[model samples]
Target: MREWINLPELGMIGLRAKIDTGASTSCLHASDIQPFQRDGEDWVRFTAHLGTLVQRRHRCEAPLVTVKNIKSSTGHVQSRYVIRTDMTLGDRMWPVEFTLTCRKTMRYRVLLGSKALVTGQLVVNPALTYVQDKPVLLDISGAP
Candidate 1:
């Protein structure tokens, strides 16, 4: 069932995401991406503009997994930062890998790709948008 996703770890709640099976990995819209080392572990700092109104900006940091060369729909190749974070859809919540890049031009801020939409986990109805109950917005004041 295609459903809305909540990126609690990224301080983004109830964000509409397209469940695209054609895509290999999940993607998140991020900006001001900066890489840094924290006690020998790789980390990245980024900002996410939530909602279409851009009412709130969530400043977040996550351990960097790797940089991947991802070819976009327009056939442009770009390197993106990969980060692991938790996603909640329906009654289940699990960790998912997301490639961080600026998707300002895309319709949705988040894309739930095939990698995160495992078999038996969900079934997408191409005609539907947000099949699940909307989640409450969390306190993101301390996101940074």
Candidate 2:
């Protein structure tokens, strides 16, 4: 079902989400992403470039897993890096892969695709917001 989502790793405090079945891999808005290191492991940090105003920026971090050549929504081939992060959409909380890219032209900074919402517990209702009354928090204190 359609539900609310908060990407705490990306500092998304409040946002309504629509569960999309038409998409394969999920996508998120990201830019100025510079891959770096901490404690000798591979990692990357970026800013979620959500608005036209450059002054407003939110920091996002993710551990670099692997980079792959994938196709875009418009059927163009593009290589993108995959990063794992916790996602809280309603009462459900889990880790998901999000393709980092510039989504300045999109309406939402994030879009939950089929891979993230398929094969299990959700039944999306497009006519409604699919509200879930629960406290959503990131379990990042022990995250690697």
Candidate 3:
């Protein structure tokens, strides 16, 4: 079973997610990632291009707290973006830390780890889709 989700800035969408209780933080296939400083604080900005030429840009800047080294499911060790953001699935919303990485080769660009889906209900039927058949979610904001 599967369901539809709406991100705070991205809007309504469908994604192939693995409700793994083993992982900690959710990982997003993000690219062109760069970090900068503003007003003596730290902020990281990057592009999230789901399935289009244009990249949907998102900026996260908080008191530069911590960056952890994590290993991906594929057994690759890399540095990822860390931030606490609001994610809404069904009628529930919570804050989650999502690391930025490139998932162009994977079926689902965004991987819903156990940490984010911990409290939400689980749907395991691969043949299922999202709620209201929302258009595949995309972040169309990075085209020149």
Candidate 4:
């Protein structure tokens, strides 16, 4: 199954994502990864590729959650940078953790793993793709 998702915190919208129940961690396509400290806190800056066909790029920075050693589908273990950000699917918004890596060779730029699906309380109907419409942004600033 697949869906269109939004990463508002990353300023990413309507990105195609493959819902992969087999994976335990979600992932995002990022390149030019650099780790640095900000105010003594671990942080990372990177360029996110919007799509495979186009060269559109988005520069983003976020607090580093951790560097995790993940075993890829190809059976290779690699350390990847992790970050927590808000994800929007349809009208629902929630915080999700993602491992940033280069996925230029993959068809989808984003991969929604089992953890994220469980956290979002999403039940995937394998027969459907893009079952949810594009997310509509909500104001949660508590100011009118």
Q: Please list the C-alpha lDDT of all candidates, in the order they appear.
A: 0.83, 0.70, 0.60, 0.91
lDDT of 1 at 8: 82
Best by TM-score: 4
Whole-structure CA lDDT of model 4:
0.91
Sliding window of 10 residues with minimal summed lDDT for model 1: 135-144
lDDT by residue (tens digit), candidate 3, 37-141: 888777677666464344444543333335768887799888766755666666566776777778777666566777676645544455655643543444468
Off by over 4 Å in 2: 50-55, 133-144
Q: Which stretches of candidate 4 lie over 4 Å from their true place?
A: 136-144
Q: Rank the models by lDDT, top first.
A: 4, 1, 2, 3
TM-score of 3: 0.68
Task: Looking at model 4, report the run of 10 residues with the lowest lDDT sum.
Answer: 135-144
What clash count goes with each model? 1, 2, 4, 0
Give the alpha carbon lDDT tens digit for every residue of 1-144 in model 1: 246788888767788787889998889888999999999999999998667666457999999999999997889999999999999887789999999988888777788888888832777678877778887764558432
* Residue 125 displacement in candidate 2 (angstroms): 1.9
Per-residue lDDT of model 4, residues 1-144, tens digit only: 889899988888778899999999999999999999999999999999886677689999999999999998899999999999999888788999999998988899899999999999998899889888765555688342
lDDT of 1 at 18: 75
How much does each candidate deviate from the true structure in C-alpha RMSD? Answer: 4.0, 4.7, 6.1, 2.8
Q: Which residue runs of candidate 3 sit more than 4 Å off their true CA positions?
A: 10-18, 52-65, 119-144
When 3 and 4 are scored with lDDT, the better candidate is 4
